[model samples]
Target: MSRIWIERLAVVLAVVALAGCATSKEKLLTHDDRTMLDIWNQETGGPAGSGRASRELLDARQALRRPLTDTDVQTAPGVQTRYTRTAQNEIYRQFHRLPNPDLVMYVFPHLTGTDPVPVPGYSTVFPLYQRVQYALPGERVEDY
Candidate 1:
């Protein structure tokens, strides 16, 4: 009976202690009476700081900033541009197109079907190789 009383007393004491430790929602969720601007001004020292840029500070920043001159930019001699927007460059980018020469064939006019309709002669081009071939970097792809 004494142990039971002690356990009950301990639980009651714990509940009371927890209640005292917990903050009330009203106090925790309460809005500040002072405006946000006023609080910021107090923290940043108003005229001295207050998050506004001064004319002298702006002038100093302008003095540091200057237009880039030709000498400021540097490029190595004999170094070429990596990529260019050209018909040949666009077709074969990153990998150079292998020397797959085109074979132009002329289609002689011929009669077709049971009706024997006349077809006009035309010229057609096809790569010697059925598919386009690409050469790896530093490989002999360009013609002499």
Candidate 2:
């Protein structure tokens, strides 16, 4: 019984070892597999043949050269207004300047400490601009 068990264990170990040694035959391509030119050439009839450009592609390229008509200028009213409003709002924000005027304060000569030391008078300056405030969503701007 011990001999049979040892033989079975050895067989199992051998199978596991052999399984780890197995490798896939398929190889991964490190570079680009296929390019547009290669596909075009294949479809046209291999590398030896000249690939003719499709008519639809040539027509689309020619269409791009044509000048825009008045009909093309007229888009859907909703889309047009939305785009215009966005552009105008952006321009307004770019040119927007908040009034951050400077404020000056004068300090009078005063006494300090328990000994009462005299301090000279001096003036200090600061900007009146407070913290930046933004309007919340759905809130209307009463003043521009």
Please write out the lDDT profile of model 2 over residues 23-92, one tens digit for every residue. 5545343355889889877776655423344555566789889776877767556445644557666765
For each of the candidates, the C-alpha root-mean-square deviation to the true structure, in angstroms, is 18.0, 14.5
Off by over 4 Å in 1: 1-94, 141-144
Q: What's each prediction's TM-score?
A: 0.32, 0.28
Against the correct fold, how does model 1 do in TM-score? 0.32
lDDT of each: 0.74, 0.68
**What TM-score does candidate 2 get on C-alpha atoms?**
0.28
List, residue by residue over 1-144, the lDDT tens digit for candidate 1.
999999999999999999997998889777778787788667655645323545566678999999767655544222234444568767756676777788899999999999999999999998899888877655764653
lDDT of 1 at 86: 62
